[model samples]
Target: MITSQTLRQESEQPRKCFVVGPIGDPHAAHGSPEREAYEHHLGIFEQVIAPACEKYGITAVRADGIAHAGDINEQICRHVVESHLVVADVSSGNPNVMYELGLRHITGKPTIHIGEAGQLPFDIASIRTIRYQRTRSHLAGARKEIESALEVGLRDGFELLTPARVLRGLQSGDGPASVSEIGDGANREDEDSPGLLDDFAVIEDGLDDMTADMEAITKTIETIGSLTEQSGAEMLDLSEANVPMNARLAAVARYAETISAPAGELNTVAAAFAERMVTMDSGVRAALGLIEMTPPDERGEGTEEFLEQLMSLDEAAQESLAQICSFGTSAGEMARMSRYLRKPVKEISAAVQQLTSAITRMGEWAAKARALAHSSAT
Candidate 1:
């Protein structure tokens, strides 16, 4: 069995950090306005961002210039949510870029926003953006700036830097306050206040529901165990009663043989029948005693029905066997006494075949019935 301690140990393993960036757009690829913007950012990422993260043993995955045929927004959003930090180029103020940036901000993750000197959007002007010129000199300068920013951000601590933590801090049950209360000029603090409380409430309610469900499941399992025990008892009782049915079947078989035999063979047939009857009676009595000894609760469901069916089949088989033996006895007697009459061999052969066929059919039916009863009990 796997214990909670084993699960915890497995979960304690370290995971690699994920990096996010923009990839599509001709400017970011070829040499367009967009390309220049992307190139400048790429140089910074490769020279500064990549090397600094490597020093810290953190993995860096660039999202810049990746061509995906699907919804770009959703892809970027997923990456942003999964990444440890997002280094965004807001130089062009592209709608898609801004959307992804907004998602990162809302996630409350470590984000470093950078752009060309004059390209930063007015809306985010308040954010301290790293300014860079389009020239190689400024690109190098931007690289160093980014490298420093990444090192600081990475060192600041990544483990406790999650959206949930920020939310918890902002709410703290200290009354309604906005992010501005923590020094951010934006009114995001107020917007997030009510939602955070609601989220916490929902989490609590879910835990309560789960606990109740587990209790119900426990009760259900107990019920199944009890029911299974009862069914077992019933089956035991049925097994015990199967013997008498066997004896009765044997008697019927003997009678069938006696009736089919010639008058001269009657004595032989009777002797065989009597011997069979004695054996069957003893077996049947023993079977009944076993059944009586079985406990009521221990009997399983459909046990009685199955036992009855089995007994019926056994009785039928015994009858058939007895009939065959009796017929053999009578036939022998007839052959001896009726040697002068010269009885038809064909008639005797047909009678033997008919009785054999009847016995075979009965056995097949009994087998099918028993199988069905066993399946239903299970």
Candidate 2:
């Protein structure tokens, strides 16, 4: 069974490990918060991912470090699906990172999950993830863990994670099977010939992510609202006390500064949500197209289940749309108020503006989803 060609193929090429995580804003200025976060992630790559991968003769590349000049999203998705291994840092549960990791998970490939201690998302908590603190020793431990996992995985082969394995089992008309039955070659085959259920699974996973993001957004919005109200009341009291104009303006500016961090965070989270919205929109259209192309009688098994899931998603999308509209209104009002301040805080104004824009785009995506769901129902 061992052929020369296979041996040559194995020896000739080195494996690639795609590093997926928050790269931070590329254009963020040095010493700025955004740039600091960017540098922090770079440190992790250099200190943890690179050294561990080098030990196994694997070349590790992150999305930002890619040299070729093409569509970035396209390139990242290609790497995620085609890479021999993936090392995903899920510390903050960044939406874009989660989306790419979800794509990799669908392939049932070798993936190593690592994250900061106490920051792992609940959705993926059951899966084994290497947790590390920011200390040097912790980072070293993470690197060693990655190396050990890679060594065992490459030698004996990797097994599918729970979600993908269960989905594949369902598609195969068998309940979840042992690793011996669904691992390695069977997983590769499933990746190569994904069925309708698999496509639906992708959409469903995205919806779940979107739902969780919306909940977090809602809480953020509420927190900002509370801060704004408390600050407003304080400002009114200062005015009633016959405080000097300059002092009142100083209070206002300080309040703007107080809310600026939360506003920026909202913008970042909203932007990521918007990216996922675009993906969900494309996924919805693609799934709808497939359904339309199939004849009703030949729609095959699971058609009813697919439609039911779509209906459920439509309901969730509707709820999310309403929440987004409300959040947009709140953000717009805050932006306007910030601009009216004597010493306008450009940072807060700009952040809220970006958040509003992202929310608007999400609203459009939600509408499109509803339209597609309606069309499919009829």
TM-score of 2: 0.54
In the range 1-378, model 2's lDDT, one tens digit per residue, is: 322233235545666789999898758988997898888899999999999988867789999889999988768887877777789999888877876777776656678899999989887899999999999999999999998876666555565676566545434343432323222223344346656556477667776786676666667666766777888798799989998988877776777777667666665666666677665653454454455445556555665565555555445545545554564555456556545432223433443454455455445544544554465467
lDDT of 1: 0.46
Top of the candidates by TM-score: 2
Residue 333 error, candidate 1, Å: 99
- Which 10-residue span in candidate 2 carries the lowest summed lDDT? 176-185
lDDT of 1 by residue, 1-378 (tens): 222243224333322233444444543447676676555556666765566445444456565443576875445555665555566777667755664565555445566677878878786786767788767687767767766765544334322223234434444333322212212212253543533223233223432342343233234323423433453454355457665655544443443333333322333332333333332322222222222233434444433543454346456445644554454454445445333222422233443444344444435434544554454456
Q: Lowest lDDT 10-mer window, candidate 1?
A: 177-186
| Candidate 2 error regions (>4 Å) | 1-11, 170-378
